[model samples]
Target: MNENFKLLNKKIKILHLIQHMKIGGGQKALTNIISSTSISFEHVVVSTFNQYESELNKLNSSFIDCEKKNILKIIREEAPDIIHYHWWPGFKMIPKNKIPHNCGIIVTVQDPTPVEDIQADIYISGSNFINLFQKHIDGKKRIVIKSYIDVREFTLKKKKNTEIIIGRHSTIYKNKIPENYIKTLLDFSLKAKFIIAGDGESKIIEKLNLEIIKNNAQNKIEIWPGEKIKEMLSICDIFLYITPDDSFEGFANVISEAMVAGIPVIAENKGGNSEQIIHGKTGFLCTGYNEARDFCQLLIEDRILRLKMGGNSKKRGLTFDHTIMGKQYDQIYTNLVKLNNKEKQ
Candidate 1:
């Protein structure tokens, strides 16, 4: 709502590039931004992987196709005021002839590697964590912009005795650590049900019969696979994420979502996660698997602490609401356009 941003109010078309719109943190961030903000500008997101067309359309997609000609044709017809790229790998495939499509490109860097070297008019990193690593390609505008959430989705909810760890089971990194979270929960002699709310883990999950152990004690671990997470997150008391050396986590939308759901989050004590949940306020942060286990134990026993932290988490969630993010990006876009015009003259 600044003067610079008002200049872009004439429905400027923006072309966004994405690897895919699957159920992942990165794609969700992109989807939320496009969906929540007021459409002051025309926008199209060309996902390389042709998934989630309906969701994209629900978010008001001007054009949702993922073909090469379709991409250029849409751009040529819309004549987008600026083409923004949020992906990395697909750029290599862009024919050199279509370089004009990207002549005024803006890319949002989700990580801190080779993506930093790519040419762009304005390079926006989702959080300072990624942008702080290396300076932008000299002279190109680089800024740290954090993703926002729909705080209305998350409010202070009373704690439920049912504890949950919201993540996948398969896919562990170096050090031969337990790759699957279901395995970790199964390893413990827990008294509460551990719900696995995502897919892939179910394949390996069935092989290990955790039900027998739960049946013996009249307690259980539930595997509710696939993406029906609204009630799961809303009712769950605790949420945890354990990963190693993941370079592409700028602002995990799940963290924002969980915060809105008023779940006390426990995550690895590194990277951009520090920006998400305030340590000991909204959530707790610890290093190593054992430390994470200890944190869960602490939350389970302390109801007052859990309720207080969950409320704080929801409060923090509102700070990142998408309206704020779009306004910030609008000003940055205006800056890029003015800079482009100044150079042209």
Candidate 2:
């Protein structure tokens, strides 16, 4: 091995414990950090549910499937310098009193609410908005680590069609499509296409379809299966979001993806969306149905404005790329390890 590689291998090891390896917000972020920091540190991910093998299989790091491996046994064997937990549920995999006293613990909370069940050496909030409602558990320094968006994954393709394509994606059950928003979309049925992409109760989809039929907008609306998010985004000219009041996005990943794809977003002004979207620049965050409708109309009417905002959105989205987050995590890991070593001495 080269000297640099030897040095990297000898550096403090990090064990990342996550709830699952499924393709979701938390899992994606964990995989991105692992991919970004692979060359600089020794890393391993221990997941409770390994039903879906992640794309991270291509990486050099190891993954311990909870089905076959005992997590506490692996922790003792590896003697990792730092243990980072991704989501709250991942904590259940660890036996309460089994953690090594010398190991530095870091828990990244993806929820908008303060975590009360577990204590850690360091805490990371999933977003700046989420940080507002959270408390510093264990009185540790709280760091806000926003979700990283991979700008390269989304191609910047300008809107080509006269028919404006508005897109949205999420777990449909958690985020309800406002009835008034649906009515507003139907109002432009002649000139626009509303594309909804996500997994939801079949009955909910059927009900929405019936509503579209009642408005004579059957041809203007398409509800896609959740798997086709990338394809839907590629064709969309603008992203429209209509979420319920109670819904809180730790960080709206799909909104960032749309922005990075060179599409201006019109999202609900609630939750962490305000942090992701710069109103009147990247996109518009609207408070009411009228504001959202007006924003959509503005984007539809002015192609130049759409292009400008889309470009700004991409620029803003690039700042949230994983490479930047990886470096930040590296710094935190280095400091925490150094502190732990000093305490031991």
Candidate 3:
């Protein structure tokens, strides 16, 4: 549709709420979403925490930071048609009295929080498990819409001769240690270079004999951490997405990115990852942290199989795209708006 036509149809003001629009891919993806969706829809971001211009510009999002105001004043000023929340901390801050009575609520549940009891008029989850649990929701309009990305920006490159890469910096959950994965790579001792890309609390530099190439010493994991995310995706032959979370991972954006990049992945068979990556086809599921290195070795030895799986991953990732996700949100918003109007009448 043309820009003028889209604007002329009905411009619904969307107040997107997030805890912190910084740090992780989930947050970044949300930012990207608002930017892309805002072209057709009226959107305003309500970030509970920091709202950096640098970060906002990356996603092409404009907004009002929620930290400065009492709930009443903020809601009144924005006068949002709907409150589409992404993070839980921000959801808690939504005052009941301040909430617009006529406006319907639609929430995108990304991760399982410590929070319980609080509800949305329309609840959406990123995976099927969350969707199934929606039957228990008080609201009738619960749904699931995966957090998908623009696959075009992350086209699968026939990997540049198996230089496998991993983002291993700033580790959060130790149980899902990349050290176990590192050991797996070391065991193979293949000609293909294996690199850890993320900065971590672990003393990784001292442990690995490999030189930490200066991308930036501050983050530590020896990376060329450029703004261009797709370049990193394009070069990697296999991606290691081994974050071992037992209870929750609403969705694995990086795993999906790797798949979009068409790199074979090895993700732990836990949390939402099991749903994100199809076993044997998109990636492998490591049941043991102890055996991570063994799996790495297996891949290093097998070239043709690795490429075939990588090819499959790319094909699967296309199914998860922003266009599909956006349309689902469009339907939800349209339904919510209609429902709210009916209630008013």
lDDT of each: 0.65, 0.75, 0.62
Worst 10 residues of 2 by lDDT: 88-97
Over 4 Å off in model 2, which ranges?
A: 1-11, 67-70, 88-101, 136-140, 171-184, 187-190, 199-218
Q: Which rank order by lDDT, best down to worst?
A: 2, 1, 3
TM-score against native, each model = 0.82, 0.84, 0.80
Model 2 CA lDDT for position 310: 85
Using lDDT, give the best candidate's number.
2
- lDDT string for model 1 (233-291, tens) is 75677787666544345677767877877777888777788999789999888787788
Model 1: lDDT to the true structure: 0.65
Once model 1 is optimally superposed onto the true structure by TM-score, how far is the C-alpha of residue 243 displaced, in angstroms?
Answer: 2.3
Candidate 3: Cα lDDT at 39: 55
For TM-score, the strongest prediction is 2
RMSD of 2: 3.5
lDDT of 2 at 212: 74
